[model samples]
Target: MPGFTKHMYLNDLNKIKSDFSNYIKNIIQILSEEYNLDSIMYILEKYYPYECQILNEKYDYYCLKDKKLIPLNKKVRYLMPKPKSIIRGLKITKKILSKTYKDNYALNFDKNLQLENEELLKKEREPKINKIKEKIDKAKLKAQEVEPSFLDELMGLYERKRTTQKDKVYIFKELEKYYCLKVISFF
Candidate 1:
């Protein structure tokens, strides 16, 4: 009997089902449960001399054959014809020309170029004029508004009390104590 190797039997079980006879299928199925259909197909197409034969017009009426599978059709080699290039013997060349003259052509070409620069300078000076106007407006507003005296508020917080001598002495003692504590903590 034609026997398959362990690796072959394990990997080509599905191929045997599709390509081989009932005897070969049963033998492969009984020999191993693990089979990779894609790897087996790849091996058959790439390594082995496999053949497919159409028995009838129907798609189902087909047979596959190899050394492991049932023999069916004659060996037919299919070759893809070499592709022909349409643009054969074509050469591409690029030439970049640079002006050799040293004279400034841009100034000669545009008469209004100096006028454009003058306009641009005028436009640049507009922001400075606007800034001066804004400063004058701010000065005018400040002149109209009354300013609050922060010094007056600070002086009021430290103003002396018109109390009796005993009360004044007690207040001065408390102030001295608070200042001493603050200075010690700061150090």
Candidate 2:
């Protein structure tokens, strides 16, 4: 019922063929505009098998066995009930190409890809994150090891003349040394 239409099956192929062929042509046009024919053909080749499966029954009845979906053969394809929607072709094409569609990348409309990409990113970021944390830990240790004499000198600068630009530079340097204020520049 997913791909089959509510309209009577008059054994006409021209109407559906026109739209189905149009869908393929549109896909070619869209892809070819951005990529070479080889890439387009590769994608179409990868997707062509599934196209046949959709023609049988996309969302509904399918020959299943042993907890796995069995692709319907040409023999049983017509035995099943037809899809009850005329828009099935477009919907199927959209769903099929939605993952490969460039706009869907920005929209995050491909649910499966989003989850997969998120997981991959987390895995990929783990080592970089650990490296950052190690760097931060090293900086903290360095800050803590600052000599007490510098602290007294910093206090004297602040107490003697807190408003001077030179005092500010001295105070900021000490703060950076002791507190690990990474980047600071006056003037």
Per-residue C-alpha lDDT of model 2 across residues 128-150, encoded as one tens digit per residue: 65676698789778776444555
Instruction: Report residue 27 deviation for candidate 2 (angstroms).
Output: 28
Task: List where candidate 1 sits over 4 angstroms from the true fold.
Answer: 1-111, 145-187
Best by lDDT: 2
Candidate RMSDs in order: 43.5, 26.1
CA lDDT of every candidate: 0.32, 0.46
Off by over 4 Å in 2: 1-118, 145-162, 180-187
Per-prediction TM-score: 0.18, 0.27
Q: What is the lDDT of residue 127 in candidate 2?
A: 69
Report the number of the highest-TM-score candidate. Answer: 2
**What CA RMSD would candidate 2 show?**
26.1
